[model samples]
Target: MRTINRTDFLSGLVVAALGAAGLVEALRMPRFEARGADPFTVPGLTPGLLSAVLCVLGIVLLLRGMSGRNLTEGAQPSITQWTRASAIRTLFTIVMVLVYGTLLFGRMPFFYATALFVFVFTVGAELIDTERRLPAWKLLIGGCLLAGGAAYAIDFVFTDLFLVRLPG
Candidate 1:
């Protein structure tokens, strides 16, 4: 039987590695204090759950890669398919967030910087894809809505209600 595409295998491996790293980091974090000042707080609530989910996803990807099973077997991806580029795009988002936090946005207001970063990154990623083209107008609108909503929600929860400082 034909093997899975090298790109798929590499992408799965990268995701699995990141997931494993995240799992390790999460495990190393200090234990949640359940008693003091609502230790079951917002920051504590979603990350642990998300970390677990990511670990499961990583295992699944690793298994798929090892099994040599094409994730899109019925609809084989073209050699020039956009998934590879999309993977790079996702990496870009991570890098952007890291840079924003460490270099620029960490000192600024979270809502403003995050909203702009989200819009720029999302729209730029769509624009950079030479294959499987998506329309500019649609990308622009979607990016705006998504970034706006995310900023609003984050601001409402962390800034307004909880009076917590979010990374700019």
Candidate 2:
């Protein structure tokens, strides 16, 4: 029987706790009955669900690891490392969204704030990575164009079609 790594077990437990916290916060939102508005809607519901599923899976993995079931027995160390990086990136992205939400409430224009976030985050991510450093020009141009386009589209849809006010 293979021994479960302590690191994996603790990581799983941490994720589960975070998921529970998020679920609680999401549930606390007041339901809305406004015409043409889905007040009970949570924007990150899908990702939240996915996070919950992942938490469950992580718990299972931790248990299996404890029970001497080696799920990653044949996996390469590099692959595992990359998986960890991906998880960290996901967490950071969530943090960025939360920051965006806070800024939106402060009367900042959503598009401008979001675009700035994209540019900062993309560049920061590239700078920190140890492998395959992206060219500065590529990162700058790509991030700006993509963020700008997305922000414009979202603003247009909300203002024109939904008749909703966005942070400005």
**Who wins the TM-score comparison?**
2
Report, for every candidate in turn, its global Cα lDDT versus the true structure. 0.72, 0.69
Checking candidate 1 for backbone clashes, the offending pairs are none
Kindly give the stretch of ten consecutive residues in candidate 2 with the minimal lDDT sum. 71-80
**What lDDT, from 0 to 1, does candidate 1 have?**
0.72
**TM-score result, candidate 1:** 0.43
Q: Cα miss at 111, model 2 (Å)? A: 2.0
Estimate the TM-score of every prediction: 0.43, 0.46
- Tens-digit per-residue lDDT, 1-168, candidate 1: 867556556666777677667766755665556545455553534665676677677667666766776665666656556677677887787888787778658776777788888888778777767763768788899999988998889888987899986774
In candidate 1, stretches whose alpha carbon ends up further than 4 angstroms from where it belongs are 1-87, 130-133
For model 2, name the residue pairs that clash: none
lDDT of 2 by residue, 102-147 (tens): 7643467777886777777777676656684678888889888977
